[model samples]
Target chain A: MAVALAALIQDPAAPPARHIAVGAASPIPAAACWLVRKAGANVRLSLLHKRRGNPFTEGTRELFDLAGQGRIDLFFLGGGQIDGQANINLIGTGDWPGSKVRFPGSFGSAFMYMMVPRTILFREEHSPRVFVPRVDIVSAPGISAPGVYRRGTAQALVTGKCVFGFDPARARFRLVSVHPGETAASVRAATGFDYDEPATVEDTPDPSAEQLALLRGAVCDEMLETYPEFCRRVWQREAQERVA
Target chain B: MDLLQLDALASLVLDGATVALPPDNSLPSCALVRALIRAGRKNLHLIGVPVSGYASDLLIGAGCVASIETSGVTLGEAGAAPRFVAALAAGTITVLDATCPAMHTMLQAAEKGVPFMPLRGIIGSDILAHRPDWKVIDNPFAPEIDPIVLLPALRPGFALFHAEMADTHGNVYVGRRRELATIAHASNRVLVTVEQVVDFDLLDDERLAPGTIGGAYVDHVAIAQRGAWPIGLPGCYDFDAAHFAEYARMARTDAGFQAYLQRYVYSDAALAAAE
Candidate 1:
């Protein structure tokens, strides 16, 4: 929610008609509510840094209503894998002991893919396991066909290494930019699919002056500075997981 | 006594047996299902399970159950799996809003021959109000009325289930979150129908699910192909869309439901087996 709050404040498309509703597979109502307010982004805020829980309560219906009524700006979803055109596949497997690990995920992925015009795909983990060739299942749709989007929806795929925005003209993921400390070749090598290696995938635009100002003054110091306990519980589990 | 023979799988439930049922929820289907439905007696109960489809509506209409004791979630009820909404509305089914775990606990108490089991972090105020049948005695220590909800045990004559595959000797392997465990614990006798009867050696470590119900617990098992009929397995067949919609429509009226039972369930067993 802190990051969502900050993302909203800094959004070039602030005061959006859709009101930047935060959709999650888990409950983060407070954080979701915070995104509507203007206080958080007063620094560079990254949503990935936060620890969250299972908020899965069929929240897809809310988004469905918004889409049916033509009231959506950007819906963000995190996936386990994404390909050239930003199609996601959250269902795991292609190997041994794989059947056991189907992460409970967005039941509305199919609906969202067809409806929400603009979607942001975030893959928290960046490795071969994700970033696959074609997905095991078509969890979300991207530029499946040219002019497929009757409404103007963009699906920007963000990974731990880089951020790739889609281009319907090519009907593939044209590199809009890369995150700090990433190279196009490394990302290309890691991908499971075939795509033209761009001459140079540009660096991801730095957080704007306004966004930075908001993050430092209003967001980082005032909020996230606290909540050490929630953060600890998460990383502690993660550490134990690593050891086990 | 171990009668879960492959050749007799179809005849086990359909040929003759008492059965307990959950309204609107489902267990896997078996191949000789149509014959079973035709041959099956009319004496059903509305217990609780997670999902229900055409088979449930047919069974209920067929009059295969006479009693009911329920506390389990339905498909479309609060925070439920969104599949069985229509069946719920059609009244061919019955369910109350409660967790499957709670239902299991209540039914298990019945199987263990208890009056009512007392313990809870549940019994929301709203749920307590609707269950007029449940009694609330004194808490004794608490000043307030006994805040606990008393779930009477449900001892069904027998429970039935279906699965992907089994062996000649009636070992059942179900997919995840299945009610097989609860069924095993709750029934006076248990019957099963499975897709294929694999060789005994095929029950490998990888193939076996964690909560495997023992043969000691199972009274009967029968092997059949396409056992999960009528109700499509998620990844298997495309659902029988027309049948579902038809059941939803017909189950609305008592006459329509009775007609359905006569045509689909209470027919001549000899003709049904031939058909």
Candidate 2:
């Protein structure tokens, strides 16, 4: 999943990303950014959660200032609920002031979604519940109406099941590819919003042997500083093997 | 330099005052929070710099906060902040939902002694729509450029936090957590609890001078060892994972939350009295 996300980030059609910033509590994105750096992409990787790796001395204030100045090329965001129009809800489920279920409050999701040119919406769980017809609350609307100053919107949404390419022009998602085990029909059944899809969907390319080795080796090691627990749970064997 | 008892330091915050707390996973002044809870402070408006977790939840659960202004309040790896979730769901406390940079920018304005700070990147968000205090206006410098949102300055009545060490001169050595310095400069009163008080001047060391905040900004200092317990102090200790897990488990319901307060908070008071 991290390798695939990295590939999306490195795609030439996207912005020539010179600098990428990963948010707090997002290990996968952090891993992806590290992988891109290891792959010799000439990208400046900034992980907000990293203890020693963070370049900013003043904290996230610098990150926000840079993004506002259009320095950040790619950023990642996730939501409790994401709708067809690309509206994300980080607030909670149900109405305002009276929510049925509450997730964490919107930290920088809305701000980064507006300022960063390419914001990828990545949610591991892709079900009817998560991909709603319309988010209960619009923490950050994917498509701003004319006259609202918005530099960007959702570029793509990568979930566990499949990757959906967002068309800002049409304001809809287009089925790109399904993961190894999942079928197109299964992806459709899981998603609640309407999207454009071809008759046949291709399988997302598996990571090359070199990519896997890099991920299991240097990438995993670099991730230890920010995501020690995650690395312990996922790449324990690789880390142990390196130690031996 | 003024050194006050924990009770007197906590009393610096009166009812209906807007207070700013540090962000999640930093030094949260846990000892001071307990003192406030014991003193029964009420109607306080709490501001979380970007995010808040344990301290915010504990205060809301204890009914000490009338309103909360923050990005999010979660216990991080321990999971949902149960008391905070319940408070929002029940609509018991007024919530002014804000994004991370918005809070920082507002506080930065206060630090700069500016009436308002113009920030980019909130023009299309629901956060901008919800905050009537935030305004979007055309750029005076470049009329052709896109409009930007301006955030009013957030001048907190008090900046309450915990640090690793403070010297006899009341200068705090916060190391790389410089945001604490910003919070102190932004607020009218800065009260800090530290693990220890040193006799030597902290600024005398060239290595630590850049990270040290001068005594002028700090109004009061108290020595409270393990002051940020449960919430980790950067280099001092790790978060009490088991205790946080227990908090997440027990704070699910109102009765359970109150029981938690009675056990940890008041019980500590009782133990202190006995001692």
Candidate 3:
């Protein structure tokens, strides 16, 4: 997942994102950002939760200021419920004020989604409950109406099962590729929203041995400052060695 | 301009006062929060700069907050803030859900003495749809451009937080956490709890001067060692993971939450006496 996200960050179609910001509770995106940086991409990373490598001294206020000023190039966001239109729901399900199921409040998802040019929607959980018909609440809209001064829109949606490329023109998600052991039919069945698919779907390419080596090496170490538990759980051997 | 006792400092915030707490993982004055809970401070309108976690949840569970204005409240890696989740589900407390930058921009408006601050994002979000207080206006600077959302200035009655250190003169060394400085600037009154009270002037030291909030902005200072206990204090310490996880677990039920309060908040005095 980190390798796939890294490829999106390094995609040639998008501008060379000089400044990338990763929000709190995002371990995979943080790893991908670090992996890209370690891969020799000259990018400045602003990790909101990082205690050691976070360059912002003023907390998330600096991140917001930079984003408002059009300084940030790339960002990552996730939602409790995402629909085919790319609308996301982070507030909760059921009614407003009194929700049946409550997720965490929308922190800066809407704000960053509008400001950053390449906002990647990454949610590891891929199921009908997550990919909804229409989100219960739109924390951030996937596409804005005409005349809205949004700098960007959803670039792509990366899930645990497959990757879906978003089309801003039509505001729809297109099946990009499925991960290993997953089929296009499985993705279609799990998803609640409608999307376009090709005649044949390809498996997401595996990261080269070199990329894997880099991810397990310096990238894992960089993740220690903010996401120690994630690193410990994912790269247990490397994390234990660091502790030792 | 010297350190006040915990109770004395806590008394500065009255019932029904709008209090501004620092963001998540920053310097939250847990000691002050305990003191407030002990005093039975009620009907508080908590303004979480952008986000809050334990402090807000503890207050809500104790029936202290009447309304809360913030983006979100969570334990981060630990998990969901149980009490807050319950409150929302019960509709017991009024929630003014805000986006992150909107909170900062509102506070910045107060800090700058402006009536309102206009922002670019949130036009198409459900947050704007829910907040009737927020307005969208045509960009007067460029009529050709789309409308922008304007948020009213957020001027809280009191700003409360914990810091790493403060000098006897009441100047606080917030270090790189400049949002604390902004909180002080925006609030009508500022009360700070510190882990240490140093004898030397913070401004005299070149390293700390730039990040220091002058005593003029600070109304009171209290020395509460590890004031952000359970919650981490940046360079000072790491969060008690076990404690937070326990809180997340125990706060799931009302009876369990009460037990937590009895153990931590009510027994604070006994724990302090033992010390």
Candidate 4:
């Protein structure tokens, strides 16, 4: 997922990520951003989760203020529920206040989704429950009407199973690629929504030798402080090892 | 400026007042929060600046909150705020869901002494549907039918936080967390707890002036060293992840949450251990 997200960050179809902001509890996206930066991209990264040397002194409000004026070129967002139309639900399931099951309330997605020019919808978990046909609530709509002051829409939706490129014009998602172990059929079965798929979908490219090396070396080092658990789980690197 | 004790500072917050607090990453005065819980304060409405974290969650777990208005509530890396979720599930508290910028915008409006302020996006979100106070209207300046959401001003009754230090002049040095300035500006009263009380005025330094909230806005200052303990003060201490993991583990159920309150929130020995 990190490799896939890194590729999307560098995708030339969208605006250059001159300044990208990553929000809290987003280790994978943070890792992907670090991967792209370490791989020689000229992107300025503002990581909100960075414990030290944080970029924003004015608080998270500064990040939003910058995005409001169209300074942040790219951002990453995820949802407890994402729909075929690219709508996301961070609020949770059930009634108005999510009485049955409450996911964390929507953070900055409501504004950032419209303020920033590009957003990559990422959720590592891929299944019928998550990739629902219709979201319980629209925390942020994927497509706004023509007159609405929307700067952008979801560029792409990357999941553990596959990648779905979003079309704002049609408010739909199209299957782009599947992971190595997964097939198009498997993706279709797991997905609750209907999406256009090619007859022969390509397998997501594995991270190259250089990319793998960078992910383990410098990226792990950069992430150790903010995401010790992720590093330990994915790269088998311990936080104490950095101290040692 | 006179420095008050922790309990005296906590006493300024009357029951059922709307209080604004920064999230865990920023400086949340956990020490003051503990004092409030111990005082058995109830029916408090908390605004999580833009979101909630350890301070908000602990307050919810102890049944001290009647309502919470914020973007989200979580323990960050540790996981979902178990007590907050449990309270919501049990229908114990009113949840006023808001997006991050909306909360910031509402407070910014209050800072400007405006009735409301316009914000882009949230037009199609259900959050707008729930927030009747948030109005949508055609952009008067637009040539076409451009729509925008207008959020009403939210001036919290009290703005509470922990800072690295406060000086004799009463200006609290927040460093980069200037959103606290917005909170201080918007709220009716500003209460701050600091790690130290220096003899000199903070505004004497040019570099520090931009980051410090003026003494004029601050209503009270209390000296509580390690005021943001458990949730660290930026540049002063790192957050205790082991403690957070332990709290998360113990806060999963009502009984466990009670046990946690007994051990940490009410127990002075545990508080001393944290020191």
RMSD (Å) of each candidate, 1 decimal: 20.5, 2.6, 1.8, 1.4
Query: How would you encode candidate 2's per-residue C-alpha lDDT over A25-109 as one tens digit per residue?
Result: 7878888888888888899887776655357777567888889899999999988899998988888888763278888888888
Which TM-score does chain B of candidate 3 obtain? 0.96
Better of 1 and 2 by lDDT: 2
Q: Which digits, one per residue and each the tens of the lDDT, describe model 3 over residues A1-244?
A: 9999999999899877899999978999999999999999899998897764457777569999999899999999989999999998888988774377888889998788989888999999999999999998888999899888899988899999999999999999999999998999999999999999999998888989988888888888788756767877888743335531
What would the per-residue lDDT of candidate 4 be over residues B1-275, giving only the tens digit for each residue? 66888889899898998999999888889999998998889999999989999999999888899999999999988899999999988889989999999999999999999999999889989999999899999999988898999999999999999999999888999998878899999999999999988888789989888999999999999988878989878777888888999999999988998998998877878567334
Interface RMSD of every candidate? 19.6, 2.0, 1.3, 1.0
| Candidate that would win on TM-score | 4
Indicate the docking level reached by candidate 4. high
lDDT of 2 at B59: 95
Better of 1 and 3 by TM-score: 3
- State the lDDT of candidate 2 residue by residue for B2-30, as single tens digits: 88888889988998889899865556798
What is model 3's interface RMSD? 1.3
The predicted structure with the larger TM-score, 3 or 4, is: 4
Q: How close is every model to the real structure, measured as TM-score?
A: 0.43, 0.93, 0.96, 0.98
Ranking by lDDT: 4, 3, 2, 1
RMSD of 4: 1.4
Best by lDDT: 4
Q: Rate the local accuracy (lDDT) of all candidates.
A: 0.47, 0.84, 0.87, 0.91
Q: Is candidate 2 or candidate 3 better by lDDT?
A: 3
